[model samples]
Target chain A: MAQGQHHIIPIRMLAIVFGLLLFLTLATVITAQIDLGLVNVPLALAIAGSKAILVALVFMALKYDNKVNLLVLVLGVVFAVVFLALTLADTELRGTIGITEPGTTELTVEPAESE
Target chain B: MSSTGTTLKHYFVNHEQQFDAAKLGMWLFLVTEILLFSGMFVAYAVYRSWHPEVFAQASELLDWRLGALNTVVLLASSFTVALSIHFVQKGENDKVVVLLLMTLLCAAIFMVVKYFEYSGKFAHGVFPGAGFEPQGIIDGKDYSKYDIPFAPQFFSIYFVMTGIHGVHVLVGMGVFVWLVTRVARGHFSPQWYTPVELTGLYWHLVDIIWIFLFPLLYLI
Candidate 1:
């Protein structure tokens, strides 16, 4: 196919990607079943992200398609990351910044009682 | 428009340019879809972070087994859609119709499972928003125990996210049915199957969203 034309992907490649996606789906479920403490969520997300990438690259034919479309996809994902990261930065750091009343940190030093 | 069905528009120099333009437009629209779902993901993350314990306890009420089943069904549907595109490119219109039918069947199966899951939740008094109550016990897990603080948030997000995604699936089914008729009429061929390719991309994106949803909501 000419550059930037309708390029046909091999059925074999698509099948392989599909198999990989199914395998990762099982992996995520299995890992979720196992309690790995802090690792569990991140691990599941990583696997899920990989599956998404696979679908975008292979099944969506981004790999064989124009680079401009790939650029668009990448930029979209980047902005999404920025949105999530900035929002979490604010939400996670809410109480610690910019709004503490002065006396809230300590009780009034009770005056030493006199006779 | 030209006499030949596959001819390019006057605005485009050639067929490749026209196809690329259409594909680019589709990708732009898909990006907007990503941004749309990201807002909900942010909500999910914020709420889950604030109430980890509540989220964990609440998620237990969702049957992960059913979620996993839906995940597999969606992935299979995505695969079939991809295969349809492959057959279309090869000019195998009959096989393309068959694969598209398989995709539609999978979408139906996914929705039926979702219906059961939603009704099951409703039967237990588990609902979104103002009606957030869980009562009775099923499968030996007391639903009443899930009626804790911020638990409503979990189910609300669950219903909203999955409900919207379910709507997408229904829309996809409608589009596929239309495509099936068009394919039977021989509207797509190796030289020009832009609609099939674009629709396949859209279907895969719906599947991708579910891949993340299955993990975040059910496996939490």
Candidate 2:
């Protein structure tokens, strides 16, 4: 509170943000219950990211603390995101599924059938 | 400077540096933990995409309402754990003890919830082996071929990931108990309260792990 005592974001604002996180998560789950195609993961991540930012900035009191620590924390999440993205790209690119382009020879090797 | 002597000045300086380094080091370690768990999350995502039906069936088998409750409990405990650190920084040992107790109680409740959930799964033969029934979907209709929740392989990963997380919760409870004992014995002060700070980092790691796990395991 010392650092942000004079100009810190209001506690009420934080409380509202937390409340919103709960509601958004609930909404996301309900939305998932319905078929939303491929929007589910990204939508869910959006809600999670919002909630995470709130927890980090407010409940964890990173706002009152040093900015360096907060940046380090954010960097971790960013790196995780990048890691997931790259892995997904690798997996998707290696195995082309449901795609039939010209001059395409897609190999579908069944592990069990190989034996 | 062979680092052989032990004067108060030298000790204090070393302690200060180590203590300061501890927080940063813990943060880096936490980042690594996040990335490690992220692997499971990615695996879960890819499998779910490929086997949406089985994953959904498996999710329905889970007690999601209980999972939601536990999630809130953890989020609240993070608040208390943070407050414990705050009290320590402000030279409020009594408050720190109260917050620590609350945090420990929250952890106990988490474990209790998890115990019931696991026991229920065990009762349903949810474990890997012949117990697992594979439910494959055909077209967009109801094709109940064994109706296995995800694949047997998927269940294995689920158990491993959640099982590891459950261990962390137990570890957190143990650490909380230690904090409570030390607080009761008047061990922490504003000048020397590294335990509370370090513990906060650990609890936050627990919370962060759940933040990812909840969605990967339940929501989607």
Candidate 3:
């Protein structure tokens, strides 16, 4: 065939990558039940990142695509997701001025004559 | 017919022209599909940000085992489909059939897992539309359950993305079957396998969609 042709991912490697992908997804799902706060975001992102890489490199034969093509594809995704983050930033910029815990009430006490 | 001879017109003006144009066209189309899905991603981001708790709570309803399995199945199918292309290019008809069948099997597995997952949720009243309910009668305190109306909206997007993807899988299977029929009839040759190359690109596109979808919908 042609030189620098796309490489065919072996079935064995495919199986291994998929196994890991499924396992991580399952792990992330189970982990979601826990109240880990910010840790949840990172954990979810990590699993998704791994799966995305596997699909890109192994399945799509991205490793075979020339540098320019990869640049276009990767940049598109980056910009798209970043757009979402920018939208989120708007909400984050608003200070929590009026928003308060339901039970948080302030008390005003008279000054005591402590001498 | 190409500018080349009548016999050579079957492929390209030349072999170099044949592969590059096909590959380029495929990539450009794929970019469009990416941006299309990007719209949904943007919507998802907006909703998730607005109702982080609801999105998370709704997501928690999904069976991760099935999602994980589908991810793996698709990855494997991608490999098999790539192998099918490889075999077809090499003029290994038997190998191509084997790989294509394997890829189809993977799709079947995905559908089966999806069937069970969707059905199980149906029984629990966790379906796509008005069927979903949050409280499972835990502790009988009539818990608020943190339920959010906007959450199932994500599942609607999720099913639409994946449902479209599943249709692509079926279409991919049809393409493979056609290839098998052609191969059985000896219509393909080592010198000309544009169909295989084109089908490989299509299959890869399907895989690419899932690669993004898996993360966007399932992960967070």
lDDT of each: 0.90, 0.70, 0.67
Provide the lDDT at B41 for model 3. Answer: 70
- List where candidate 1 sits over 4 angstroms from the true fold: A1-5, A96-115, B1-5
Model 1 gets an lDDT of 0.90
Q: Give fnat for candidates 1, 2 and onward, in order.
A: 0.67, 0.30, 0.33
Candidate 3 residue pairs in backbone clash? none
Tell me the spans in candidate 2 whose CA falls farther than 4 Å from its real position.
A1-25, A33-35, A96-115, B1-19, B129-131, B134-146
Ranking of predictions according to DockQ: 1, 2, 3
Q: Write the per-residue lDDT of candidate 2 for residues A1-115, one digit (tens) a residue.
A: 2211222344465456557656766776677677787897788777777777767767655676556677788898888788778877876676666545544544644345455
Flag clash pairs in model 2: B54-B150, B133-B148, B134-B148, B135-B147, B135-B148
Candidate 3 chain B superposition, TM-score: 0.83
Error of 3 at A63 (Å): 2.4
Candidate 1 or 3, higher DockQ? 1
- The lowest-lDDT stretch of 10 consecutive residues in candidate 2 chain B is B1-10
TM-score of each: 0.93, 0.78, 0.74
User: What are the clashing pairs of model 1?
Assistant: none
Rank by TM-score (best first): 1, 2, 3
Which DockQ values do the candidates obtain, in the order shown?
A: 0.50, 0.29, 0.24
